[model samples]
Target: MTPSPATAAVRVRRAELSDLDDLVALEQATFDHDLVSRAQFRRHLDSDSARVLVASANHRRFLGTALVFFRKGSRVARLYSIASLPEARGKGVGTALIEAAEAAARQRRCQSLRLEVRIDNESAIRLYERLGYRRIGPVEKGFYEDGSDAFRYAKTLA
Candidate 1:
């Protein structure tokens, strides 16, 4: 049976242990040397402080993933990782995931969301800027495994 276009539209939801392999593949596809290993994904999957979300078409075709970390007794949530598959770039997958992350944070009583993006990621920077996230601090040198610098971005949720 053919699937409806609406059904195929990217949908963002919490990641599950069953999505381990897909999440790992997404990490590999999204980053080079600094890939998060399977064990790390496993830990995040089980962690109370972390929320792993995935964007998929029809709930089966993986398109992207986002990992958010929350601290107990803290109002700030960190967007630790977010990436869209190369084939899914510019298709609104990233935006959907970001919106989902923000909703999750707000639901958890977080007052704001912060993330670090590589300085060279112009597209991502543009997306964040368009979404109302602002640069908050000095550049973080050698933040990535490949020695790339990063820029911190923050968005108030309240």
Candidate 2:
């Protein structure tokens, strides 16, 4: 059953080491190849500049997640990943996770937020546009090792 917005029971919070399995599963389900390894995820979890946020329902069911990395000298944060379970799409979980990431970036005094979306990912592009992100440029093919073109987007927070 889908959870309502008021009682969605979905909470967005920092991912702990124990959440590695669920985070990896969600990443694999959302992307093609290039799935992040457990070791990579653990490293991010332990890093001060990287963050992984998870959205969970009923405090147990993982619904979605977003990964962000902040560059120390540039004051620019990159949104590395944002994905929601297929069944959980359109439930506002992705939005919540993104807003959380924005808050986190702002907390770190980031001046802008950036991300790259696959050229064919219309839904994600629309979501980012609606959230005030604008396309900055396009990266050539083979950017993802899957030959998918990527569109870069950025939003100035400061």
- Name model 1 segments beyond 4 Å from true: 1-8, 58-60
Report the lDDT tens digits of candidate 1 across residue range 17-132. 89999999889877887788999999998898999998887545688999999999999999999988888888788888888889889999999999999998999999999889
Model 1: colliding residue pairs: none
At residue 109, what lDDT does model 1 achieve?
97
Q: Which candidate number has the best lDDT?
A: 1
Candidate 2 worst ten-residue window by lDDT = 1-10
lDDT of 2 at 93: 81
For all candidates in order, the CA lDDT equals 0.88, 0.84
**Per-residue C-alpha lDDT of model 2 across residues 13-123, encoded as one tens digit per residue:** 899988889988888877886677788999999999899998877555678889999987878999998988898787678777877788889999998999988888899
TM-score of each: 0.91, 0.89
